[model samples]
Structures are given as structure tokens and as C-alpha cells.
Target: MGINTLAFLLFFVFGITVFYLLPQRLKWPFLLLLSLSYISFKDIRGIVFIVLSSLSVFLGGRLFEKRNEPKDASFRKKILILTMIFNLGVLFFVKYVKPIYGAFSGKTPPELDKIPFFDSIIIPLGISYYTLQILSYLLDVYWGRQKAETNYGKLLLFTCYFPQMIQGPISRYGALSAEFFKEHRFKLHNLKFGLQLMLWGFFKKMVIADKVGPYVQRIFFSHKEPYGLTVVLGLIFYGIQLYCDFSGGIDVIRGVSECFDVKLAENFRQPYFSRSLGEFWRRWHITLGSWMKDYVFYPLSLSRPMAKFKKSLKKKVSRVTVNRIQIAICDIVVFLLVGYWHGAESIYWAWGLYNGIILAISALLTDVYAGWRKKLGVDPKRKLWDNLFIARTLVIVTVGWIFDCSKTALGSLNLLKNAFIISKTSFEPIVLNLVDWVEIAELIIFCAILFKVSRMKERGVVVREKIEALPFAVQVIIWVGMIQLVACFGRSSGEVGFMYANF
Candidate 1:
């Protein structure tokens, strides 16, 4: 169910209620049972795949832990490699195979006709998320950062934790498992804080995202080719719709975990205020970016091949230049993988390559840019330059979104071509098609309010805590008003599915 919907709300309420009601010893099992039940709601195949995958990783972890001594390190590495191959192999077959198969064979391969329930089987919910989580867990064990869990049930619950099993701020084994296993006594403050976040999420999803959906649809899905302004509007609105939808869902996930006294990693950190594409990535999908940095980028960059390459460059360039080149290469590779992680489409690959190129150029030109800024007497710390950089970053990010939101690479290119050449100057009739002038004004007002809140957060103001310090009655009234406003204006385009959930 969509997290914003009543069904999920009820499910969460019941789950948390029973979780707290249970004795300490029964907590893990109860959660495991609940999680399995939740997965079963998606597909029976999902349960089987997740169980088998979890079991394999669990076995891999145990073996690695056993063989992880200095003498047995080689064998432990083999186990890690085998486990990664198996898990990633399963992920590929389930998720990517269909698209690859379609690209080659016009029709379904006749070979599949022999397998039992092959047609019925599909990629399960949270497969991408949980696969990464499991991989990270196993890797952490191998890296000696965390011990492998012997308790199958606890590991199972960790993998299938219902809240994060949807869209995730992907958790780490070392940081999250202890909180997962802890007994949480209900507290009024936790309840209030969690509910407040959840309410904000609902507001973002139902009121903001859903309201903008029609306009985005109109522009992107037009029968005739859309003009420059329409395409630009579509890109901007899609960015808003996507950010609010995905981040809002994360907020709901975090809030739900909070009610159980489990804290999730923060995913977004005022990404719109980011002054550079690199900084934007560091803020946006903070967990995934960090995960990639830890698991993929650092290892590859530090590999013997790269070390040799760096040594070769040492005689030709300054150490600072070498470091920049190394970082740029790693960043590009990570972003390419990040793009591939989004989907099995060429569009996604192009999107990743697009960002990679931009970042690479930015890195390579850092000296030139700095010198130019110095020549122009520009201080980056000054407000004007900071805001200019933020605006520039947003424009770059929005251009990237064209690739993300379009149907194909060529389609995105066409949209980009149109974006540069304005064909229509008047947008009144176009905006009127989806909404009235007054509603447009209201939308702008809502955006202003969201911007203000984001700016407050960017300044490191603890907004929720500030609210918490208010009088009890005033807090209640504020919360009640939030609920009432949502109830009055909230709308959903039937499914209410999160954009990232598809990934």
C-alpha cells in the first residue's frame, strides 16, 4: 500500500501497537512474522526469493566470520565474492533480465516455457533496497566493522523490517541492528515527534505532489510536441513532484521507525540549496551516495591498478592535481553505477554518463574556475555568489531531469533542444488548461512556504524541536490545523505510488 494511504496508516498503527504490547523476548519474532506477512501481501514469490537470499547471505556471513583470520583471509574473500555474485546474479535475473531479454529477442524466449511458475514470478518489492542492504551487511562483516549475526530470526527481521523495506534510507548493519533489537517503551514525545513527521510527509505527498501531477502529465504526455516553456515547466514540476514524493515517503518511513524508537539515516539535507552538482548528490539520496562511496568508489579508487596509475601521474602533475584526477574518475564511475541502479534502460545509462561528464569537467576545471572567480573578485562565501551557485546547480540538475523524465534518450534531447529555443512566449492558456490563475497563485504561495521551511532547515534550525518547546495546547492546535488543512486539500491520482518505489 502507498505509505500516505489510510491502509498503510492503519497497518502501521496496529503494527506499532502490538510491537510495544509484546514482551521483550517476543519482539523480534513478532516483527519477523509481521514482516513476512507484509511481504506476502506483495507476492508469494517475493517471500521465497527474500528468504533464500537472506539465508544465503546469512550462511556466507557465518562462513566469512569463521574464515576471517589472517591465514584464512583468502578463503574469506572467496566467500564474499561468491555471495556477492549470487545475490547480484539473482537481482539481475529478476529485475534486469526482462529488459535485456526484450532488447535482444522480439518475443519471449521459448526456453522459459519449461520453468515452473517463471511467468508468474516477478521482481519483488524492495529487492533493490534489501539486496544493497544485505551486500553492505556482508561486506561490513568481511571488513571487520561488524560481527555476523547468528540469530537467523533477528537477521531476517533486519532484512525485512517493514518500514524501510519499502523505499529506504538504506541502513547499515553496525548502526541500525542494535536499535532494531532494542525494546522501546512508548513515550509521549516519540509519538508526537513521529506523528508530526508523518503528517508533514502526507502534506508533501498528497497536497503538493498530487496537485502538480496533472500539469506535469499535460506537458510530458501531450499528443502534439510541447514547446520550450511547457517542457521547462514539465521538467521543473517533475523535479518538485519527484523530490516531494520520494523524500516525503522517506519521511514517512523514518517517522514510522521513530515510533518504534528506531532511527533511520537521514536521506535529504536541503538538496535544492546545494551550490554544486557534487554537493547536491552528497545531500540528495545521502545514504545511497555514501553507500556507493564506501563500497564501490573508495575500493576501486584505492585498487592496485589505480595506485600504479597515480604513481605514473606523479611525475607529470602536482600531487593536488593527481588527487583531483583520482577523485574525478571515482566520482564518474560511482555516478554511472548510480544511474544503472535506477533501471535497466539506456536512458538511465545516459543520465548517469551525463552527470559523470559534468562532474568530471567540473573537477578538471576547478583551477580555472577558481582563478576566474578570483579575477572577478567573487567571494563564494558571500550571499550573492552562494545564491548564484545554488541557482546554477538547480538548472544543471533540472537539465539532467529531462533525461530522467523522458521516454528515451532522443526524446530527452529533443526536449533539451526545445528548451533552448523558446517557441511560445505566452503560458497563460497553457497554465489555465490544468489550473486556474488563483490556484496557480496558491501553488506559488505553497512553494514559497516550502522554500522558507527548507531555508530554516538549511540554516541548521531544529524546527520540530522548536515546535515541541511550545505550550502543549498550542502544539496540539498546530498539529490539528495541519491535519485539517491536509484533509481539506489533499488529493491522490488513484494509485499514489512513490516514484522511487519503481526502482
Candidate 2:
């Protein structure tokens, strides 16, 4: 069940109650039970696949460790390779196999139906997320960063921890298990903080994201094709819709997880305010970027082939040029794979290349840009300079969203080209005639609040702590008012699901 739903809320209330009531040892097993139970509610097929995936990696880790008798490195490498193939193979089959096959065969595969495993092409919930966690665990064991888990249950708990099992701030075993197995007392502050975070998430989801989503979908998919100024408006709203939907869901998940005294890693960091495309990525999907950096980018950087290439390139060019070229190569490859991770869609790959090429150019031009800025008497600490970069980055990111929001690469091009027109959009008549001005006003006020809060966070203000510092009665009244606003506005948002859940 989605965390936003009433059923999941009730389930969570009950589960948290049982969690706190249990003894320390039973709590984790009970958590495992809850996770397994929750996934079963999502799909029986999901539960079976997750368990199988978990077993494959868990066994691989154990076997790899065992092969370390006299450190038989080759056998361990073989085990690691086979294990990666099995796990990544599953990811590829479920996520890519259908689209790739459908492209070639021009029809759905009967072979998939013939497989006895699942009834239909049902991709498991959080397969992309959990598979990353599982691989990270196996790799950690192989690298001797940590020992393999002797108990499958504990390992499974790490693999399928419910909150992180959703759209994740992907965790590694060494960092996560320490938090997982530790003792947690029921603290008033933890509850207050978590609930407050959840409330903010609910506001973003129910009020902002859900409200804007329909408008975005309608405008993007209209029979008239993409609009002009309307296309700009739709994409701008889409950016807001996407961020709140994904990050808001994450906030709810992380907030609730915090009540258990386990804080997941931060996923977002005022990404829109970032100064560069690279910085935007570093802030947005923070964990996924870090995972790619550690597992993919750094490995490519240090590998022997890259070493040889760097040497050859340095012979033809300056060392600085070589480093820039290296950055270009690695960033492109990493982001290309990352794009493919989402799907085999043309738009995704185009979006990936778009970002990669810009980031690479940004790297190559850094020294020149800094000197130009110096000559222009531009200082980054000044407001205008910072805002300029922020605006530039937002435009770059939104341009990528043109790709992300469209059905295909050509569709994206249509939107971008249409975006330049000054003519009246056909969608405006519908917007004016049918739109609710009251709801629009509410959106404006809430958006203002959201921007103000984000601005405060960017400025290093701890907003929740500020709330806590207010008079207790005042805090109660303010919270009561905000909660009521959410309830009132959110009711009209209907049951719009989190956008990233499809991934």
C-alpha cells in the first residue's frame, strides 16, 4: 500500500504501536514480518521475487567470503561476477526487457507469458531501489568493507526495510545495519519531529503535487499537441509537481522511519537553488548520485584502461585537458547507464546525454569561466551573481524536464520548439473557463509558503526548531491551522499517486 493512503496510515499506526511494545530482539524480526507482509499486500509476485533476489545476494556474499580461504581471489571474483549477473540480470529483464523486446518484435512477447514464474509482466515494487541496496551489500562483503551476514533474517531486514524499500535514499549495509540493529527508545522529540516532517510532506503531496498534476497531464497530452506560453507554464508546474511528488513521498517515508530512531540519508538539498547542472545533480537524488560516483565513476577513474587512456591523452594535450576529458568520459558513461536504468526510452537517453554534455563542458570551461567572471568583476557571494547562476541552472534542469515530461524524443523537440511561440495557446480557453480561482489562490499561498520554507532552509535556518522555539500555545494554534489547511485543500486533490512509484 502507498504511504499516502488511509489503509497504510492505519497499518503504520498499528505497526508502530506493536514495534514500541516489543522487546529489543523481537522488534527487528517483527519489522521483517511487517515488511514482508506489506510487500505481499502490494503483490504476492513482488514478495516472492524480492525474497528470491535477497537469497541470491545473501548466498553470494557468504560463498564469496568462504572462498577467501587462503584468499582465493579468482574464485571470489567469479562468485561476484555471477552474483552481479544474476541480480543485474533480473533488473534488466523486468525494467528493460519488455520495452526493448516490444521495440524489436513489434508485439508483446508470448515467451514472457510462457514462463511459469509470474502470470503477467508485473515488475516488482522497489526492484530498482532494493536491487541497488542488495548489490551494495554484496559488493561491500566482497571488498572486505564488512563481513557477510550469518543470519538471513537480519540480512533480509536490511534488504527490505519498509521505508527505504520505497523510493530510497539508497543505503549501504555498513551504514544502515548499524542503525537497524541498534536500540531505540521512544522519544517525544523524535515523534514530534517525524510527524511534523510527515505533515509537510503531506502538504506538498496532497496540496501542491496532486493539484498541479492534472493540469500538467492535460496540457502535455492535449490533442492540439504542445502549446506555447502554455507549454512553458505546464513544464514549470511539472517541475514543481515532480519534485513535491517524489521528494514529498520520500519525506513521509523518512519522517516515519525517523520515529523508529533510524534516520535515512537525505535525498534532496534545495536542488533548484544549485549553481550548476553538476551541483543540481549533487543536490537532487543525492544518494543515487553518490552511489553512481562510488560504484561507477570512481572505478572507471582508477581502472587500468582509463589510466592508459589518460596517459595517452596527456601526451597529446596538457594534464588539465586530460583531467577534463576524463571527467567528460566518465560522467557521460555513468549518466547514460543511469538514464537507461530508468528505461530504454529515447527521451531518457536524450535527457542523460543533455546533462552529461553540459556537465562535461562545464568542467572543461571552469578555468576560463572563472577568469571571465573575474574580468567582469563578478563575485559569487553577491546576490545577483548567485541568483543568475540559480536561474541558469533551473532553466537547464527544466529544459531536461521537457525531455522527461514528453512521450518521446521527437515529442520533446516539439515541446521545446513550440515553447518559443508567442501566439495564444489553445489550452488557455480551458484554463480560464474551467479553472477554479479559489483553488488557484490557495495554490499560490501554499506555494509561497513552500518557497519561503525552502529559502529558509537554503539560508541555513532550521524551520522546525524555529517552530519549537515559539510559545507552546502558539505552536499548537499554528500547527492546527496548517493541518486544517492541508485537510481542506488536500481533499480536492483526489488520489493522485506519487510519480516516481512507476520507476
Candidate 3:
């Protein structure tokens, strides 16, 4: 079930109640069964995907365990790598190969159509997320950083936990497997906090993200030439839509996990407030960034070629210069992978390359710019000036959102041109008439709430504690207001699926 649905809400409440009433020893199995039931509720065929994911991890773990043997280390590493490739291969084949093959061949592939009707390959919900989690687990096992879980159910549950089974913070096996098996006692604090997070998530997704959806869709789908202000506003709205949609999903996932007394990793940390692309990566999709750093970038940087390049460069350059070069190279590789991870499209690749180039340039010029400012006696630490710079940087980043959302390179350029050069008269008749008073009102309210949350986020105040400090009457009123708002304004025509679900 979609996270933002009435059915899922009922399921969550029922699951939580039954889970809390169960005996401590029975909780894990109960939750596992509940998770499986939930998956089955969505599609029975999903079970096949789950089984495939579980078996992949199970075998990878077994192979990793054998790597400790003196005579088998080399063979085990090879097997581990092969296992990872196969797992990723499954994900790639299911999600990408057909579309690519059809695009080139002008017809659907016979092999894809030949699968049994019952077992026809549909991309499983959260395959990308769970596969990454399981692959990381296998890698950790191979590296001796974590022991392989002996229990098959725990491994299965880790990869298919109901709350994060769809979109995820992509929790590591080491971080969550033990907790999955542990007995959970219902804590009043956790329940209160979880509910509060759920409320805020509803506000983000239903109120902010959904409210902006029509405008974003219209701007992107329009075949007519766009006006400059319309294009700019479209990009701005898109940036807000993306953040609310993604962070909202994570909030719901984290809230549900908390109800079970499990703490998932935080996925967002006010990414828009970041001053640079480098800082933005650290804040946005934090779990993925950490995964890439631990498993990819660090290892690659310490590999023979990179290490030798660094050593050779060090002999001819200053330490700072060498460091910058290393970071630039690593940043480009990581960002490219990050882009490719999003989709098989050229647009995503371009988006990744764009960010990488920006980050690389920023890193390369940082010292020179700092020295220039120092020479001019400019103080970057001044709050007012720093805030201005932050605002300007945010605008730049928002404009970049056009690239992320565009369907093609030419489309992106046209959007940019419209955003900067077109006169309002060209499209004023069509665009100006599309504005809705209700949506505009909702957008204003959402902006106010977002600003409040952003301020709380900046001050290091916990959102849960803030909500708890309010009187019971106030809390109840807030919840009632949110429910009413969602009922009144939530998209009702059709399912407004989470945007990141496609990934």
C-alpha cells in the first residue's frame, strides 16, 4: 500500500496494536508475518521478488563467511563480487533493459514477453532500495566488518521491513537486524513522537507537495512556449515539490519504524539550507551518501591507482593542492554513480554530471576565493552577509531543478530560455488563468509551516519535543486541523504516488 493512504493508516494502527499486545518473544515473528501479509496485500507476486532478494543476500552472506578460510579468500572475494553483480543485474534487467531494448529495436523484446504469466517480471516495490541494503550487508560481511546473520527470517525481514519496504532511508543490515529481532515494549514517548512525525509528514506530502503538483505538471507538460516568470516560478515550485515529497516519505517511514521502537537513519537535514553542493549532498539522502563513502569512494580512493597518483602528485604539489585534486576526482565519480543510480535516462546522467562539475569547481576554487576575500578584508562570518549568500546559493540550486525535471537536454534549454528571456505577454492569457485560489491559500499555509519547521531544524530543537511541550488540547487541535486539511485538499481524483517511488 502507498504510505499516504487511508488503508495504510488503518493497517499501521492495527499492526501497532496487535504488535504491542503480543508476547515479547513473539514480536519479531509477528512483525515478520505482518510485513509479509502487508506485501501480500499489495500483490502476491511481490513475494517472488522478496524471495529472490532474500536468497541473494543469504547466498552472499554464506559466500562471505567462507572468505575467512586461507585457501578460499581469493575465490570468496570473486564469488562475493559476482553475487553483487547478479543482484544489481536483476534490478537493472527488471527496471531498465526492456525500455532500452524497445527504444532501440522498435519493438518489445521476445525474451521479456516469454516469461510465465504468473512469474512475469514486474519491478518489485523498493527493489532498488532493498537490493542496495542487502548488497551493502554482503559487502560488510566480506570485509569482516559485520557477521552474517544466521537467521534467515531476520535477513528477510531486514530487507523487507514493511515500513521501509517501499521508499527508504536504506538502513544497513548491521544497523537494523539486531533491532528487528529484539523485543519491543511500547513506549509512550515513542508513540507520541511517531504520531507527531506522521502529522508533519502529512502536512508536507498532502498539503505542500500535492498542492504544487498541478502547477508543476502543467508547466512541464505544456506544449506552448513558456513565459520567463512562469518558467522561473515553475522551477521554484518544483524544488519545493521535490523536497516535500521525498522528505515527507522519509518522515512517514521513520515514524512507523519508531512505532516499533526501531530508529531508522535520518534521510534529510534541511538540504535547502546547505551553502554548497558538497554540503547539500551531506544533508540530502544522507544514508546513500554514507553508503557511497564507506563502500565506494573511500575504497576507490585508497586503491592502487589513486594512491599512486596522490603520492606522485604530492611530490610536485602542496598538500592542499593534492587534497583538492583527490576530492574533485572522487566527487565526480561518486556524483556520476549517484546520477546513474537514479535512472537509466540521459537526463539523470546530465543532472549528476552538472552537480559534480559544480562541486568540483567549488572545491578547486575555494582556497583561491578565500585568499582573495582575505586580502580584501572581507568577513564571510557576518550573519547578515552570510545569510544573503545562502539565499543566493539556494536560488541557484533551485534553478538547477529544471535540469532534474526536464525530459531532454533540449527541453531543459528551452525551459531555461523561457525562464530568463520570454515576455509575459506571450503566455499570460493561458498561464494567468490557471491559478487556483484554494491551492494558493494552501501553498501559503504550507510555506508558513515549512518556515516554522525550518527554524526549529536550524535551532537543533527536536520536533517531537516541541510537539509534546504543547498542551493536550493544542496537540489535539493541531491533529484535527491537519486531518481536516488533508480531507479537504488531498488529491482525490487518483493516486498521487510518491515521486521517488519510480527510483
What TM-score do all the candidates reach, one by one?
A: 0.95, 0.95, 0.92
lDDT for each residue of candidate 3 in 68-141, tens digit (9 for 90 to 100): 78898789878887888888888888878765665565554575476464236677778888888888898888
In every candidate, how many clashes are there?
0, 0, 0
- Give the total clashing residue pairs for model 1: 0
What does candidate 3 score on TM?
A: 0.92
TM-score head-to-head 1 vs 3, winner:
1
Local lDDT at 134 for model 1? 92
lDDT of 1: 0.84
Report lDDT (CA) for all predictions.
0.84, 0.85, 0.81
Rank candidates by lDDT, best first.
Answer: 2, 1, 3
Summing lDDT over every window of 10 consecutive residues in candidate 3, give the lowest-scoring window.
111-120
RMSD list, candidates in order: 2.5, 2.3, 2.8
Model 2: residues with Cα > 4 Å off, grouped in runs: 69-71, 106-119, 425-434, 491-493
